[model samples]
Target: MKAVLKRCLLGLATFSLVAAASGAGAADPFPQKPITLIVPWAAGGSTDILARVLSEHLTRSLGQPVIVDNKPGASGNIGSAMVARARPDGYTLLVGSMSTHAMNPALMPNMPFRGVEDFTPLGLLAYVTNTMVVNPSVPAHNVKELIAYARANPGKLAYASAGPGSTNHLSAVLFEKMAGVQMLHVPYKGGAPAVVDTVAGQTQLLFSAGTQTLPHVRANKLRLLAVTEAKRSPLLPNVPTVAETVPGYELSVWYGAFGPVGMPPALVTRLNLEINRIMSLPDVKEKMNAIGVETATSTPQQFAAILHRDADRYGKLIRDLGIKGE
Candidate 1:
């Protein structure tokens, strides 16, 4: 009887130890499975391409596949809302943009998600170069010339944008307000479509990302007027900045990564470090530069500050301009 009791006691102890070990293992490190990177824009656009490139590098770095899932609509609100509502686990992430994080909230009346509060900013990915381009048929060689012509023609000239609340839209609005000109505003469903229509001469002007417009410029389908950055782009040294002609006209779009709110701080730190490292790579910089994208990396705190600042800046601008979402 004493030997049987001893064996039972030992078995019970062994079971407890095994259970505790299992529990510890269950709380394993992040990215135990594939990660979903939500790109809140249509495929083949700048955001989608950037997300895909980063996802490829992230997969190699983290030892798990990082898939880019496009859920584009409502000027990036549909997909952004999905990310905002996703579980706080590191498995779900966002390839967010200024349009979704800053511009949309200010322009859209019924935003589905609270842009800043619903997500944890992991890091800033890049600052995309925006250029003002016109169809080859337009009689404008530079920014000053374009403004002169627009002023001469008034509402006869029309400009294309990604949508109502997009950076493209706001950039054009700012241009109008500063230049003291009024041209027709044509908003499309996405940047790709807007670029397509502008290339087809359905619209006369476009202020769009370099990745989307550079190829058209090179192909001679569109003519580059002025870049919207404060300074001339290294990729286009001869092309002057809009600020050169219109003193304070500067608008640049940026991209960043985000995780759902309540993500583990350690996980956020890990992602920010890895992404910054990836963005700093020589090969990565070369690739991004080729498409007219400047690699920009920032800490989580810095990124959050940028969001807050832009939100205030753009929100007031949107209200002041009476801009409404589509």
Candidate 2:
């Protein structure tokens, strides 16, 4: 009996030691299972494409599949809400962008979730500029020409947007306000449709992301006028910036990754490191450049700070403009 009790005690001690070791190794062996990256946009969009690209690289590095799930709607709010409600475990992540984090919050008065509060920033993935494109039939070759024509036409000239409260929408709204024109505003379900309509001549103009608009422009379906970026895009260096004609007119779009609120710092750091590594890859940079997107990386803290700053800036702008969410 004494021998049996001693053996039981030894087994208990061994079990405790194993448990402690496992606990210590928890974060180190992170992502033991496949990770689900939720992109709050339709598949094939720039944000979705970026998520897929990063997922591929993360899969190779972590030896686990990184799946992408696109849940697009509500100006990217529905999918973002799903992420906001997801568990803070490292397994579920969000490919959040300025649309969902900054513009949506600014436009929606009764936003379902707070941009900065609802998520733990993993890292900033990329920053890309948008272009203000019009149909070739519009007779506007540049920003100054477009503004002059818009003024002459008043409400006759129309511009399409992905939706109300979307970055695309507010971009036009701000543009109309600042340029002192009366262009009619048309809203669509997504950026693709807006770009398509603009390309097909159903709409005269739209402010669209480089990825969505560049293909059509290159195909001669849409005309490229001015980029909304602060400077000229490497992809379209000849095209001028809107700021060139309208001083202080700069509206850019950016993409980032985040986890649900309260995500483990260890997991966040790991994700940031992997994503930054992928961004540094030449192939990855090349792919993004082809779509006219400039790749960038940032820490979780830095991303969170950006969200806060943009929220405040856009929120004030939206309020001042009386922009309503769709």
Which model scores highest in lDDT?
A: 1
Q: Which lDDT tens digits does candidate 2 get at residues 131-237? A: 89999999988999999999888998989998777788878887887788898988998777888888888899999888778778878888889998788887778
Candidate lDDT scores, in order, read 0.89, 0.86
Give a tens-digit lDDT track for model 1, residues 1-326. Answer: 99999999999999999999999898887678999999987898767878888999999999999999999877788998998998998888999988788878877788899988999999999988898999999999998899899989999888999778678888898999888999999998877899999999999999998888988888999999999988888778999999998998878788999989999888899999999999999988898887788888999999999999888888889999788877
RMSD of each candidate relative to the true structure: 3.1, 2.9
Per-model TM against the reference: 0.86, 0.87
Error of 2 at 276 (Å): 0.7
- Misplaced by over 4 Å in model 2 are 1-22, 25-28, 200-202
